[model samples]
Target: MASAVLDHDPPPKHLDEDEDNDCPIEQVRLTVPTTDDPSQPCLTIRTWILGIVGCVLLAFVNQFFSYRSNQLSISSVCVQILALPIGRWMARVLPPTIIRIPLLNWSFSLNPGPFTMKEHVLVTIIASSGSGGNYAVGIVTIVKAFYHRGINTMAAMLLTQTTQVTIFTPLNPPLKKKQFLICFFFLRSPVAGIRLGRIVQEILGGFSVHVCDSIQCRALNEEERRPKGGLSRLQFFLISLGCSFAYYIVPNYLFPAIGSVSVLCLIWKNSIPIQQIGSGLRGLGVGAFAIDWATATSWLQSPIAAPPFVLVNVLAGYVILIYILMPLCYWTNIYHARRFTFLTSHLFERGGAPYDLDRILDAESFSLDVRQYESYSDIYMSTFFAISYGIGFATLTATLSHVFLFDGQYMLKLWRQATSKANEKFLDVHGRMMKANYAAVPQWWFLVILVSMTALSIYACEGFGGALQLPYWGILLAIAMALFFTLPIGIIGATTNTFPGLNIITEMVIGYILPGQPMANVVFKTYGYISMSQAITFLSDFKLGHYMKIPPKSMFVAQLVGAVIANACYFGTAWWLLTSVPNICETDLLPPDTPWTCPSDSVFFSASIIWGVVGPYRMFGPGSIYVSLNYFFLIGLLAPVPVYVFHRLFPEKKWIRLINFPVIFGATGMMPPAKAINYNSWFVVGFTFNYWVFKRHKQWWGRYAYVLSAALDAGTSFMAVVAFFALGNYDIYAVNWWGGVLDDYCPLANCPTEAGAYIPNGCPQIQ
Candidate 1:
């Protein structure tokens, strides 16, 4: 929930298109469409036909792009836009004949009158729901590609020493269709958080990110509520979209150096220390910068959408942790830091070689081979990677503490207000219309879903002959975990847009209990953590339905049907890609400059090995080298207390409340999947537009900043897909040239400092 304090639109300095904000925007001037048609056809043939088409297409497209190093997709907004013309055309061309079924006493028409806004909303709900890529699919990637395959992409850097060791002794190399099919049933729970989130809600909720999406509907929808001058929103959006699309080709395919230009690396090309300090991908990235939107917005969400305060707070923590703390830990050779690379998520041996799973892993049990492990070297990490774990431990506790300290009153007030008899009075026209015009979905419907999903979850866990390994009681415990965190997480999310995930806690808990079983740990975390995320998203969709005045029953049907169909498509698409893609997630087998490197899946696998296979006890238990990192949890818990006290003591100093420990600690959470370049470039862009522009040109910033962010995302995503199809995928691959790939000319950055340490290809031995 670090992004919980990401951004919020304060009291508007200027009026909306047809609005004067005399009342608070949250209270009275919410951006929901004021007018609605009670009789507008919502769940007609048009919605089903169009929704299914969009859902299936997006499900395929999103899943397809996810494996790329620079992931991009045809966004749901694109579906929203494309769905309009197709929807309208279907309404016009289809037969208007009505058919009646006398036995059931039901009647329906093939053509619903001009595709209504409610139909549009339902279509969107269905398609977007389907396109939310399944998170549990990562388990498939880990199992099929990383663990059982005996080869996986290590990182951007490769080792000279050769070893092809499967992380798992033997599961199935190719995941049986049944294994992934089980995950599909659970995909109904957490679609939105898996792939994407809406932008306007993100800004208001304060966690809007531009990652995974090039085109966003949030800006368009919000801008529609505002007055247009000169170029219209669409006109400006299209223009920027075209510009960013064209510009990305340069950095993305042609001159990759444009994406990350480290002056220090360029100036001192032969100096190992200089390269180590300057490489954006491999090293500290002290003076790195990028003009590319993809790199800038990859890790952190769009800076353009963030407020000045949010950017500053994040920048403060980033500089302090990365610049100040990381360097100190690494340079001082703490924990034998000099034995490993300067910064990386990959684990290593004490002797500075990649940790060989073949040596220490028990082939039969998928557990640690204690005897072999003792004979082999202990697992170690780069100083930065080690610190990242400490940050994660701290972030989880800090999120809860920060919420109670700062937003407790607001939350309590909201709860009281919600429970009070006067709650009905707060209902706006949209809410009242939803209540009056639509029959509410019965409570039993939810109970049925809950019971059925629970049963399926248990079956997924244990029905596979203990393959998934989670007990039935473990399923209940997971649900209970979700139930426990839901209210607080919901409150924190509702109050602040950021959702602090329970992945860490869940992993820690399950690791402590079920140490040897790797599958159980990740599966438990998925149900506990990802389940809560999906629940929040489900609620958010309901809120949107209410805002659009869609029938409650229609919304329910759309969501359920969409989840089922979309999830199947999501699974089918992923299965196809996993089976078909040559080498898949294994960079060891793939050709150089290949785009099929699965960075996220690699991180997920690392996490499974650390938290699940080895167990947290082995990694963070007593007698472990990094046991002190656990103290960060306590540190995170109390970190907010001082800030709260300071805020209380000096009521005048408004800045103290901005100190978000969750954001600070959690900032590095994405480090492995993300790297130094992503963070450095993201901070630069976020600071530029949010702080510099917001201060100097509030009017322009308010009008076009969000639009530009969305447009860049849209343009970049479109181009990426195009580039992949045209040049990067299949036999074509990225063109060979100095400009064809991203590099900071810092080849020695990943080299270790200790004597006898070595790397592959060009990486030098330290001796």
Candidate 2:
């Protein structure tokens, strides 16, 4: 049986000529699989297919309006709110395959099995908790302090960092996967909180006994396992909060030294002892200095050479090969392995049941099977990108065009799957059976939420510190866009998030195109803030995938769903909150002095230069610094030019290995040298602590460590929120229980001065 399973290899793929499978132009076929297993029945959902089509169509339409009416603001609310549900519905109904021509066949299907009530609640909770909102709120608090309370940028930064690490960091763990509304409601409502606790006890208490060893499974009946062999809930929570507080200090004060050390430690500690981490760190350091040197030199020489050199630096062969080429190939395949092959395998073999090995091995068996995607040929790549670019441009063409390209497909596929299973259970040849682990979420609840969003937009008009305010037209457009653009962004396959609406808004407000619009000013002012929020969501998804053992592809798809839903729901609620509560938008609850107040003049001039002038350096600003460092360090190692010259001059000895090691280290040593050191330190500390407790003393710390960390973050956030409200951060309350003492005795330690609390304005901006 093992031999047979191993022997089954799909057929060598042929280039697909299907119209849908053709390349778009100037794009590389990064993901091309050369296998085809035909025995399995095709279960492609059309919703995703339609969703992609809808996005392209809508993008084209948006482009048309952008050109004709010369207004891009029409699609803002529409694109953000309903994109996920639309995508989900489309994926359920659309054909599952997304084929491309030229020696490739890959899967981009939208069959994630059945969803359950727990999954729905879990997703909604996670989406709504304002995961990104915390960052936005932090920025707002700083800005408010700077402008309203006459504080400088340095002081504001310090205060923000302190507040974030100490207060908000600890609270994230318990609330990470919950809905934002639920968190607020429970925290605010005493009666509802009590009721929820009772419900949890009644349902879960009886279930804990059988699985008493797991806190997550505390629902099982067993008091012995509950909080046993570990710290109590309160203790764990505080620890997480403290850790979060510590995190704020590292980036500012410790990054320089700690980064390189961490890399070096990883190299020393790893079984292979490769200097991969070290090399990456050096790249960052060199790149940072290189920019400074290049900028200084270019001004001294001809300015013409600057543009070409800048482009060369960015698009250099080494940079492209290491960063773009390798990751595109490896990550894409890894994504497939995780999403299609890994996750579904468990489902196929559940309960010692026999599965159709042939069906399971089919190349087209996965979601969004694209038969034409085979090889990384140049022509194919160019064509694929052209199509993508075209779709983006089309968003500015006509509204009808917008509907065609951006419509959701995955949602459609799911809907059909549900319908099919309603009539017949999954059965394979020889009477074997296939089943889903969880049941689907009820349709009624889904519909009710949809209706509720619509109702709120039309009526309530505001929500949550006046953070939400969608006009009727905006809400309508959201419904339409969501109906179409959902699947491509949400599911697995050859779909896309053109970011068309955002582009339109940017061009209108920031560019020279549109003359005036009410929201245009606001859009320009907040675009940078918004981009960061989006970036965090993307990175968080990647991190979650790394930890949860979810198939990479499935995680990617799941994340898209989570992201789209959160973007829409969060924005809508924010709008409503703003409209409901007047003057709140003027305060620290939201970032003030943005483009929203004056669209035409509030162009993001500084941001434009940051993007155009110092291109690659921008990645070094926040979450992206580590990745950039890694890539440049790779380039430094493989640069060959200097090494070749040195080898020629000294022909007597063979020191290639030694020379290679130094060069690699030099490059890695440049940027994040501190990271390596810190990582090593933390690892050593962790291991030593573990050894002392577990090996010598015979104690287990695993039971409590991770949970404790998570609890601490959540607990700290809870306290911070209470403190923020109480200390007059917002208009919630006026009595400061700890404020007086902090001011008198601990002035520098988070005391609220006339310029607001805990801000240190000493650090310089990257630019």
Candidate 3:
């Protein structure tokens, strides 16, 4: 049975010219397979072992990192780096005995052959699934850290595991043929039983045969298989690690004092020109570090990673909009930017005090009491945040316009081609592999997952008073929203590597639906936003598996198992940190130097208050100072029309098509969570690698660019995890010198006013 399933002809030498020409440029150009090795062992014992271990490590590190102020995630590059050696080592050591299932009639060798590229990729994907902070951790962090509520660790683990498991289950194949055959045999009537038996036999027979039997699966040469100018795995891993270690040590330990320098503080220092020069140097150092960290992983993964010119356009947009425009706006005091310390998601009163929701909440229900809320003064936002709203709205409209203008015809054609049975042919090598080797996930499985999770979510919300008592209708509405936006968002994400987040849209909708119920609003938004996002994520992984020539069944099992392991590890790690770390998420209790500031959670909590408790109607409604911001949506929608029109009118002018308004507008909001240093630094790094290196040294860039990205991500994340547990938790200092201090070296970075209206800590008094 295993031999029959594994059997395949050599891959085709040349792709169908007609099909290739018809394919969208992006899809056709980048769809090249990683290898042409037909005998590559995909599902093997070594792959499983490495995948499981990688998943656990990644999950723990990701969850641990989530609490830090910088908000670094353990990138998938880490797993990609770590998996190669382990998989190969296991392949060498593990026994190769062929194991056969008794009733299933399936037999497979434990080790298979040497660890192939497909196996390595599968392991990395599985590990990546486990790594990175899951949204479920937010519930635990917010409940325990902010609300000061007690949650059972076991219960939390169970709920999180169940949620993740159910979410990924829809990606799996249907029940095995044996189970269906067993059911079919129970028919009482002889005629019905005979008919059903024949149908079942046909199905079973089909499952046993290989789909590649009909198609020619010819092998290609190395040049044909992989893109030219790429480095080996080892080269990327080692260099990135070295660079990442250097990056972490220099700013963090060796010269911490140079990390952040403020112009205001320097000028205030007794009118010393040297002090101003020192401040500029400090800014340069900090900006360099920020750029190094932010751009390392992102550049490698961006859609224009290989294309220098396209990357330059993106960098241009990022630099002009974020670095140049935003700072100019701030300096000019546009929208009263000087009145706020930071442009964050946090809500504030008109007086710039933190909006105290506890003052208005019903003590027993924890819901907003209208009478109490009415007694409080009007809520206000910083100029930065107000602009963020405008940008967010603008970006959304711009993205839709850009897609419609540039990719509309292709998208429509693709959709029609996908739905039409007559033209249903595999367009690429990966598509052919999918058709030849695997059966798609059944629709019924998706329905089952949807129904089960919906039920579980309702129970969690209503049954547990502490879990935010959201009604069933709100949950239904969230699901409907997910269904509505999934296709459009998914298409954009797949093509452009940019997902216009549904956070704002979902929050706005749910806020209106269930106003004054902060918990309910948040819960509804989570369901609406995350469900579709996760689905898209799973689909991407599935496509990745297809590209790597992994069997669909194996990919499904790997994801399902990886998700379960990740959930458990994440929950366990989160619980440990919450208990073991002293005064987590409490700035007052911990020393100023502590990394466990929980900035992400703080942002989440603040968002809940703004979109959930106070509601947008009172904040951005009629007569409000920010009411003018709502029209930005229309402005966003119209902004891209002209650019598209010009491109169409003068197709020969290549420069006209270079302007991507969505990229520019989207970059404007990258402050607070991200700082000016990050933007400035990211631009420099992006230009150096994506522009200079890619254009000047194309061979070297293609070989080492992505590998460098992976290595840096792995090294930094691994070192961070090690540092926290080994030295950070023990309250060990890295020699208290000026260079090793934690401050951005900017005393007046926040720009505090004379009225003490926006006085953040460490700012100098203006006497």
Report the number of clashing residue pairs per model: 7, 197, 9
User: Per-residue lDDT for 232 in model 2?
Assistant: 51
Models 1 onward score TM values of 0.83, 0.28, 0.81
Q: Quick one: best lDDT, which candidate?
A: 1
Question: Residue 718 of model 2: what lDDT?
Answer: 35
> How many collisions between residues are there in candidate 2?
197
Candidate 1 lDDT score at position 206: 25
The TM-score that candidate 3 achieves is: 0.81
Q: For candidate 2, what is the lDDT?
A: 0.26
lDDT of each: 0.65, 0.26, 0.58
Which parts of model 2 have CA positions greater than 4 angstroms off?
1-415, 421-472, 492-515, 518-705, 708-712, 715-767
Q: What is the lDDT for 616 in model 1?
A: 84
Runs in model 3 with CA error above 4 Å? Answer: 1-40, 98-108, 152-233, 261-337, 342-345, 423-430, 442-447, 754-767
Please give the ranking of all candidate structures by TM-score, highest first, separated by commas: 1, 3, 2
Q: Which is better, 1 or 2, measured by lDDT?
A: 1
* Cα lDDT of model 1 by residue, 1-767, tens digit: 10011111122132123432332235324443355556567778788888888888777767766787665544456556556667778888988888676786566788857766767777888887754566776766777778773222221001100000000011122333122100111223411121011111222232222221212333433335435446756667778989988988887777767777888988997777788889887887879877788787665556665556656666766777778888888889888888888877788887888888778767766676778877887778777888888888887788788877787676566545434555554344444444455554543555466555565566666664556667877766765676555555665555334555457888888888987677788777876777766666665665556555566567766777777676666666766778887888887797766768888788788777778867888788999988989898899999989999999999999788777777666667777777778888777787777677888998777667766776787788777768777875556655588756666778878777787764646776666
